[model samples]
Target: MNKTLLGSIYLALASSIWGGMYVVVKIVVSVIPPLELVWMRYLVAMVSLLVVSFITRQKWRIHKRDLLIIIAIGIIGNTISIVAQETGTMLSSAQMGAIITSSTPAFMVIFARLILQERLTLKKGFSICLATIGVLLIVGADQVDLSSKLGGISLLVAALTWALMSVLVKRVPSEYSQIMVTTYSILVALIVLTPFVLPRLQAINISQLSHPAIWGGLLYLGIVSTAGGFLLWNRGLQMLNASSGGLFFFFQPVVGTLLGWLILGENIGLTFWTGSIFILIGVILVIKEKK
Candidate 1:
């Protein structure tokens, strides 16, 4: 199969897995504290990826020159980003989290142009505007009272952190395999989450383990969302042009919105549809301009 076909398939699968992840997270968070859930999810993901790394005979060693960079990527890309995202979900609705996170592609474009000197086109500029409008419509329909302060701040932090991670990933040298980078980055995330794990462990009642929702959610997150989704995404990016690979992200919010309705029985109002239309338009415009 051609690289474009492979990339498209992989990206679609990644988005679907990610969409389902929101439902799983909602289920698990009911039983476990958000911090604990985050720690366990990454712990499982780390172990799974480590095993894959070993099986594939991927090198674990990094040059001294790249060690700090890898660590930074781990902290910012894996650790901080996940923390922000999960915490944001806990504080706000999953719909809000998904919509805000969709803005990452726009941020990625801006960061590429400013930091990497990549050319930006008017089509992409228009798409970014449309996406912003879509996000606003979604936020408005939700009737989010940012008067709470903390919830609003958390969502914004999640958006910014995810954007930062995207830019950081682009800065990494092509010589480093995406799998190796992802594995190392996840390992660091495990380390960063360690402190929270023990405290949560002490608080958990043994009875909670017997809850089907808890284990099922964790399994879904570890196997499907984190491991499978990420592996496919890395493969897709390897096969496709960077811009094309980035455009695939545009599907995430749409998938997320559908999943929200199917799983959570969340009401999708007119604003939701209108906002999605704008977001889609914006994404198409941006990619066309980039081309």
Candidate 2:
């Protein structure tokens, strides 16, 4: 298949994996706290990536000049954004969290313009606007609670930082393969989070850790969701223009909402389907623009 086709497929699968991850996360969090889960997930991701690097024969060396950018990506993207997202979800309802997190693509377009100097043409602008509205509809803006101000703010922070990280990934030297970048950045993030996660580790249920379900969830989140999902996402972003790639992120909420209904028994309404149509239109516009 062509690179574009492959990239699109990879991105779609990545989003689906992440969407399904919410169900797994919901189960795991009942046994493990969010902060501890973040550390555990990344730790598994880091080890899994190392195995991938070995198999792929990826270079591990980083240029002296590139070291700082790598570190920043690790801290901002992995550590801060994830912790904030988890905190936000804990503070707010599922609907509100999903809607706020869906706002990432909008911020991504804005950051791409400012940081990467990517031109925001009329088509791109319209696409972003359409997708943002679709996201709000998909999650039902009417369901949002204004009372959870702190949670709302935290989710916004998660969205912005994640956007910044995506743009920054493009700025990294091509000398480092996406695998190398992911591995090293995750390593850095693991180191930074260790101090905090270490304290929380004490509370973990050692007997529960041995359960197949718990380990299964950890492996899925760490290896599949973190390692596989991110690799596909970053690779797709590398292949497509940032503004256009941002549009594909709309797939996250679509898959997420569908999974919520099928797996969690959440109700789906007319607004959700209407929103899905708009999101699909936005996705089509970007794909056509790319062609």
Candidate 1, 119-194: lDDT as tens digits: 6665556666677777667646355545545655676676666555655665667687777888787788788878
| Whole-model lDDT values for every prediction | 0.69, 0.84
**Model 2 misplacement above 4 A:** none
Candidate 2 residue-wise lDDT at 226: 90
Cα lDDT over the full model 2: 0.84
What would the TM-scores of all predictions be?
A: 0.84, 0.94
After superposition, candidate 1 runs with Cα above 4 Å error: 1-9, 135-142, 234-247, 269-278, 281-291
Please count the clashing residue pairs in each candidate, in the order shown.
Answer: 2, 0
Task: Look at candidate 2 and tell me the lDDT of residue 127.
Answer: 83
